[model samples]
Target: MSIKLGIIGGGVMGEAILSRLIAQQVYRPDQVLVSDPQAQRREVLSQRYGVNVTSDNGVAAKADEVLLLAIKPQVFKAVASDLVSKDGNHSSASETLPMVISILAGVSLTELEAAFEHQPVIRAMPNTPATVGAGITAIAPGKTVTANHIEQAKTLLGAVGEVVEVSESLMDAVTGLSGSGPAYVAVMIEALADGGVAAGLPRAIASKLALSTVWGTAQLLQDKQIHPAQLKDQVTSPGGTTIAGIAELERSGFRSALIEAVQAAYRRSQQLGK
Candidate 1:
């Protein structure tokens, strides 16, 4: 039997994608190959998922079907060297090498294509919420990538949540909004909980309220196809408590602060790519 999916990197995000794929039965455990540097991680993945696990990046990189690069950007150079090395003896040796789909932040398609040389490469930005199948991922495909390749990437990525295709030019913006957006939302949740405590609610209940409110509101917006402004207007009866809070939020520059945070994150992502 052939390994249909090869995963490089066995960290949190890697495991999140792996577990979801397996849970959805998109690929059987036997068809997956996971590579990690640590023996303990390799052992755990093998035992838990019954997938083939190895320390050789080359083995995973040369997988027969799709290859996922879940490694950190910092280690990509070392890993790429190993994958592309002449001594590896796998370079150009087969025509069935997998298309590369990368979730490595700050790694560009140009760099991925330069390393793989011949395979279709896709750069993906996925948020932390993907761990629970509530997140969204934006993918940018390389020049060699076709409609079929995009669909393939989407099928795999969709197991975790939603997958959207965007232009490479908009990836940085996607990074700013969705990639780092979770942290911003987490902060908002925290602050909302704190505000509830300040208003005399118990800490635990306040936390739950904050989390549920955000989650439900997002679901409602999507379900109703309503704009956020429409939701706000619907909730904010003239001269009511909701409008009172909205006025305070506007005065405190809440919207501008979030906007600037995204801009800053976008700039930082650009810097890292350089």
Candidate 2:
């Protein structure tokens, strides 16, 4: 509605949020500002979204009421330094600082608060599906955040996908599950395609079938609000091919492998945070 949002990176995730916000009419392109170190990226986003773009992170940070930190975690410290004064406070002389929402992976609220010097911070973990407006994001707020701050954060993130509020302690689990889930689903799709090819289908047809099956099954489960097991049982008859396939999957420990994968990712996320 107004020119009040600033994003610190113009990368894929950053641009995804920007595009979705505009598509949802939550914010207009002219109302949003973005910053990227790459001049080409800045120009591209400006041309693509009609949003103001600058090479100066501080300029974007100072110009907005809400700041979205979409920069890579490895470069967060350097970028943050540009937004703060020598005393580690917002460089602006104004008493109030912008509410910050960060999508940087493995960065905890404690680290963000420290970097921004006690600014209200919301840490969000959103996966790649957000690029297409089908993502789910988990958000955790810092100690200084208020109810209003939470609403603001949700409104911004909800433009792209579903939002879940979680305690900071469970963020690593969220990171493991939905945050890294797209890769797991992609692997599953590829394996399904390969299986179909092994059974004598053309590669292109196999790939399309696998992708559509996954998409349809997901839609069905969501639309019906039924457990996956219920759906599996519905398709598995006493002597049907589905049961034969199910047996093979069980024999291969498919479910357990997925569970272990999520657990491994959770542990890795914790390690990265440390």
Winner by lDDT: 1
lDDT string for model 2 (149-232, tens) is 999888999988999999999999998999989999999999999999999999999999999999999999999999998999
lDDT of prediction 1: 0.90
> What is the per-residue lDDT of model 1 for residues 1-274, given as tens digits with 9 covering 90 to 100?
7888999999988998999999999999989999999999999999988899999988887677799999999999889888777434136624656889999988889888888877889999999989988879999999888899999999999988999999888888999999999999999999999999999999999999999999999999999999999999999998899999999999999999999999999998899888
lDDT of 1 at 59: 81
Q: Candidate 2: which pairs clash?
A: none
TM-score to native of every candidate shown: 0.97, 0.95
